[model samples]
Target: MADHLRDRFTAFFQKNVANPVMRRNPLQTLLETTGRKSGQPRRTPLGGSRVGNEFWFVSEFGDQSQYVKNIQANPRVRVRLRGRWHSGVAHLVPDDDPRRRLQSLPSFNSFGVRTFGTNLLTIRVDLDN
Candidate 1:
């Protein structure tokens, strides 16, 4: 019951508050996914690190996340890193340990993910050269 309520509350806060503010920030990393139903572009602020040609992040809500669902429909995506957009293919890495993975990411963001996240899942985006 608490988890359900927390999910609902966090989803509302993220969609209504945090995301809007973060999206407007030039420095915030963002993931762009094609909407499956609307056939439109959707951008979500994310916390991740770029390693070589791959960008790594974890979805706090895992498969229940709308962005993850969009990725399921289309793996092709874009990521804004350091104010530049990069085209990439998003991959869900269920085999990766999300908790462990978070330890290697940005501390502040990782802490939020650990606190508010109900279902942790790792996502990897391999950028095109």
Candidate 2:
């Protein structure tokens, strides 16, 4: 499939199917980024792991992801991990190897990301203590 077509299809499935289900699960990890245009909090269910005071994840669509665009607009964000919310600053690490980073994250999500992601990008969130 062409990248644009795949992206569109995947985004549709995620928005209409996957995300709604995931968001309802209290155990699901979530990233809340301010809407770049609307200025409202937008919660996106994600798969990642917390290490020390930082949380790391790979964006399946790189800068093309809506949350990533929001991060570019406003780096300050909130993350919900294991049912607790933490405030943080989000950063896009273009230099990081997303494929290698995915190896360190949850296998299930990494699998989906690797399968559907066309342009993987690494994201790091420095959590507030």
Candidate 3:
């Protein structure tokens, strides 16, 4: 990653996404999903939190995220929450749910607003390991 882009994204994760309190705690979880076409695993680091017993994550890039689509068409996933990777599955928010309210919130980057892309895929996570 280029220095400038890396610095900017780091700022977003630190300031806007990752909680200040959780920074010191090993509470983060990363989801690594495979490309539906290639079958090879692609790891995309994300800031995750729990909603009840289920895990949740907001995509920084919305639906245009290849990994998001991949996981949508294929629910199985792999995760690395605390320096370890574990295989799991991911699912999208059903259109019928009231949780769809999240779509209205203004998206954010560390510096400013984030324009949503086509996929608009906001989904909950299910872990097997």
Evaluated with lDDT, which candidate comes out highest?
1
Q: Which portions of model 1 miss their true places by more than 4 Å?
A: none
By lDDT, the candidates rank as: 1, 2, 3
Q: Report the C-alpha lDDT of model 1 over 1-129, residue by residue, as the tens digit.
A: 999999999999999999999999998999999999999999999999999999999999999999999999999999999999999999999999999999999999999899999999999999995
Candidate 3 global lDDT: 0.56
lDDT of each: 0.97, 0.97, 0.56
- How many residue pairs clash per model? 0, 0, 2
| Tens digit per residue, CA lDDT, model 2, 18-72 | 9999999999999999999999999999999899999999999999999999999
Q: What residue runs in model 3 are displaced by over 4 Å at the alpha carbon?
A: 1-28, 51-53, 94-120
Question: RMSDs, each prediction?
Answer: 0.5, 0.8, 7.7
lDDT of 3 by residue, 27-64 (tens): 44556677889988766655555454455655645554
Which scores greater on TM-score, model 2 or model 3? 2
TM-score to native of every candidate shown? 0.99, 0.97, 0.55
Evaluation by lDDT, superior candidate among 2 and 3: 2
